[model samples]
Target: MTQEDPEIQILLDQAEELYSSLLRGETTLADATCSEILIKLETAIEKKKHELKQTSKTSQLC
Candidate 1:
């Protein structure tokens, strides 16, 4: 597997923690931050994957 970008890793870790907390009933509706974090994490992962894919294509063309 490809190594994860540091920023992506951090976001993933944070999102995971938040999700787990929600699952355990530790977070309330007042704590709506997890949804935001999940959205950010999804966007970041997609951006990183797209960047890597483009880089790979460029390398292949060279």
Candidate 2:
């Protein structure tokens, strides 16, 4: 498996922290707001992963 890029890792870390806070009831975010934030973060993470994979493939072919 390929290593996660640092930029992606930072995003993942932020997502994890947000999730943890939500689980602990530390935030006042509404349910809909939380869902939207999570969805956006997930989408970003997926896009970053795809880009990393594509970059790695291109590098291998160089």
Candidate 3:
């Protein structure tokens, strides 16, 4: 895997954690700020999800 790829995953994980914290009242940022990371995390999640989806699809076709 690429080195930068892991960094992206790490940030996505962190963003997810922050989102959870905000949901539980552990974070004090405004909704916009919290939502910002949430958006990024969702995007990253989608990228990974797409990769998994393609992998599964290819394996099935194989």
Candidate 4:
């Protein structure tokens, strides 16, 4: 894995934790709805996955 892979994994793990917290009713944000939060989390996860894929491709080219 590239150096960035671990960082991306960390972010993904964090997002998963936040998701679990939301499901458990443990997260509170005054200005955002749960659906909004989930959408954002999904976006972040997709972005990280894309980044990881790109990183892997670049590493393969080296």
lDDT of 2 by residue, 1-62 (tens): 21545655665677677778878898656863556556766777788778879999999999
**lDDT of candidate 3 at residue 7, scale 0 to 100:** 55
lDDT of 4 by residue, 1-62 (tens): 32545654555566677767767778755322455545655666688788879989999999
Residue 21's lDDT within candidate 3 is 84
Candidate rank order under lDDT: 1, 3, 2, 4
Better of 3 and 4 by TM-score: 3
Off by over 4 Å in 3: 1-5, 16-34
Give the clash count for each candidate: 0, 0, 0, 0
Worst 10 residues of 4 by lDDT: 29-38
Top candidate (TM-score): 1
Q: Report the candidate with higher TM-score, 1 versus 3.
A: 1
Candidates' TM-scores?
0.70, 0.52, 0.53, 0.48
Record all residue pairs in model 1 with backbone atoms less than 3 Å apart, i.e. clashing. Answer: none
Query: Which regions of candidate 4 deviate over 4 angstroms?
Result: 1-34
In candidate 4, how many Å is residue 49 off?
A: 0.2
